[model samples]
Target: MKEESSVSRLQIMSVMGLSKQRNYLLTQYLQAIQLPRGFGGDLVFEFQVSQGRVRHLVLDEQASSLKEQTVMELIRRSLLAWLPEESRSNR
Candidate 1:
């Protein structure tokens, strides 16, 4: 049906928009962490979307000896701080 197709199109557009926003935010976070005191080694983040939910992995080559929970908590706080006020509120 035309209505169903329109709804599907809208959903696809929304997903794509979210993907773009996520990528931009990730890039900004990466840039912000380039400082020596932030993240010294190669840092990579992988994002996967499934069933409208987004999951992320942060790999820091320099994080050896650091507790996983600690690293994740730091990254989460840093990324949240990097996000816009509106985006932070939405989360």
Candidate 2:
């Protein structure tokens, strides 16, 4: 039972880490005016905010098996964690 719980925890953490990595990549590509039309098999996140703040994160070759909705949820969670503590925008 303990081993099972530990494995479960690790799996959850792995998902979270993947989400964070995707977010970080997106932040790096925010300003890209042109991107590959398709990345073959990868999870891509295009995050956009007001005032021209745009972020594009990608998890190339590492997220092909995940559903689109799942990936989106991960993106949402990562963004929520990233926002400034003082920001009034509620989830």
Candidate 3:
């Protein structure tokens, strides 16, 4: 992982679009682990795999300026719902 944000909203959106456009079999399972305000008000999104590979995306600077509630709503509407079904068994 990189010190800078490894994942961004645009990157995630691009993946979603590519999945559709290319008809690739990709499953993205995202869960809101917790609201870690101590970490500069970041909302943590954890992407888990059955093989024990876990990737986390902390919505820090990208969402730092927004209220907690607003951030949550934005995530729910834009990111969460766009995530593909959990293909844990396949992984």
Candidate 4:
């Protein structure tokens, strides 16, 4: 379990790095949202946006019963709501 967790963390970082490398827009978007808590935990949520689309938000860890798809949909709706018209319409 601990090994899987470590691998997941590394994978997330690699994905984030690739996202930043492949898409400057995504990198910039991610920068807008702040992570109040560092990644990896059960009690905190990390925020990010990519390709002008918000990424899935994980309020709970993988061990929790929360659905990942639902969480992502919620984040998408939320990002749309929070973003200004110019930002949304332009994409």
TM-score of each: 0.31, 0.24, 0.25, 0.26
Error of 4 at 12 (Å): 23
Candidates' C-alpha lDDT: 0.43, 0.38, 0.39, 0.42
User: Against the true structure, whose TM-score is highest?
Assistant: 1
Q: Tens digits of per-residue lDDT for model 2 on 1-91?
A: 3533211110121233234544454454332322323222234443444332324544444534545564445544664444422233433
The lowest-lDDT stretch of 10 consecutive residues in candidate 1 is: 6-15
Residue 60 displacement (Å), model 1: 7.2
> lDDT tens string, model 3, 1-91?
5566523321132232233522233323233333333323345444332232323434444644545575466564444334334333445
lDDT at residue 28 of model 1 (Cα atoms): 54
The true-versus-predicted C-alpha distance at residue 59 of model 4, in Å, is 0.8
Better model by TM-score: candidate 2 vs candidate 4: 4
The 10-residue segment with the lowest total lDDT in model 4: 5-14
Error of 4 at 31 (Å): 21
- Cα displacement (angstroms), candidate 2, residue 67, comes to 1.8
Task: Flag regions of model 1 displaced more than 4 Å.
Answer: 1-18, 37-40, 44-76, 80-91
Error of model 3, residue 60, in angstroms: 3.1
Predicted model with the maximum lDDT: 1
Q: Give the TM-score of candidate 4.
A: 0.26
- Model 4, runs deviating above 4 Å: 1-43, 60-83
* Residue 39 C-alpha lDDT in model 2: 23
RMSD of 2: 12.4
